[model samples]
Target: MKNYHTHTKRCYHAIDNEEEYVKAAIQSGYTELGFSDHTPWHYDSSFHSTMRMEEDKLDGYVNTLLKLREKYKNQISIKIGLECEYFPKYMDWLKQMLHDYPIDYIILGNHYDDTDETGIYFGRPLTKQQLTKYVDNCIKAIETGLYSYVAHPDLAYYDTDDEFYLQQMRRLCETAKKHHMPLEFNLLGYKTHRQYPNETFFRLAKTVGNKIIIGTDAHESDALLDMKTYHLAKQYIERLGLELTEEIHFLR
Candidate 1:
């Protein structure tokens, strides 16, 4: 099995070093494990982010992972990547970052609207307008071709079963299908009983024919050692008859 949404302590919110997560993935029998720690963006403002690594630490993050990739080459494939938000103002900087670093891939986290510098968190149960805005931002992000897949595709946490919610999600799923972007079945949310990995969204994804990819979204090292959630998530996806993709397009 392969999982791309892994994290490291450099992000400040996760636990352990990159190697510990790598060992855990090997222990869990994952053929490939990607370290997509929350990435630091070059903010035009002095907006210090406590959730991701610092922009200055970007090189260190890449270099360390490169070494680990070589060290664990025979055990499991290690991909060096980042989980990034699509802050439009910093897109050029992010593009430059992609060019400067040997980043293998990036996944769209969409943690905040606009930029986390001054935006609402997407996890909260959103207003109809906020949810629609979230969908719009996701469509824009998908169109960029920078992100490999949409992690936590159903992140906007809109709780009721209403036509407006369905309409927004339908458009989101359709756009993803058109772009060939697989929406992630976030294992973190499922295992934690979070609002995401929402059944309604996946049902819409299934109907819209969007491909699904399972993401561990591992914040802790041992999160990878346990494969029960992965197995259960697999069974859940299989039972839904939604197509699950094991491979993704690397950024090269």
Candidate 2:
């Protein structure tokens, strides 16, 4: 199987080194694996977070992954990528990063809104206006055509009104369909008993015919494809009859 949304210890919240994750992928019987650690941002304004690697570490991250890619070329296909949140203020910097680095792809994981100066984390309850803004930002990111897929498209949901939730979610799905970007059914959320893979959202996605992809969203090495978790995700997909996109074209 293939999984693009993986992480490394460089993102402080995750565990283990990159090579350990590679070994885990091989042991898990994966033919293709990607390392999409939380991306480092170079914002003009002061922005600090322990969740991602620092800007200076970006080169080291890419070099290490490229080395591993060549070393494991015959064993498994290794791809280097990043899982990023879109802030329009840093969009140009992100594009420059891609051009300067050997990044194969990027996945838009919108975890916050506004800017580094003032942002709203998705974990908290959001007003309808805030929710609409989140969806608009996601659509804007997709329209940039810089991301391979939209990861955890349902993550923006909090305690918003059911009607408003459905309305905004449908809009997100329709925009993804328009851009031909797949929406990730994140396995990490399922494993952790988190909010995503939300029934209402996926049902809307199914109705709108949005392409689906399964992302391990692996923060730790063992999470690559733990058999039980893998089966649970597979069953969820099968039961929903969602159309799964197995491969993606990297940015050239």
- The candidate scoring highest on TM-score is 1
Error of 2 at 18 (Å): 0.5
Q: Put down candidate 1 lDDT per residue, 70-166, tens digits, no spaces.
A: 9999999999889999898889989999998999999999889999989999999899899988999999999999999999988897864888889
- How many residue pairs in model 1 have overlapping backbones? 0
lDDT tens digits, residue span 66-183, model 2: 9999999999999999999998988888999999898999999898895644788865677888889889999899899999999898887565348879888888899999988999
TM-score of every candidate relative to the true structure:
0.98, 0.97
TM-score of 1: 0.98
Q: What shift in Å separates residue 244 of candidate 1 from its native position after superposition?
A: 0.8
Off by over 4 Å in 1: none
Query: How does candidate 2 score on lDDT?
Result: 0.88
Q: Report each candidate's C-alpha RMSD, comma-separated, in the order given.
A: 0.9, 1.2
State the local distance difference test value for candidate 1: 0.91
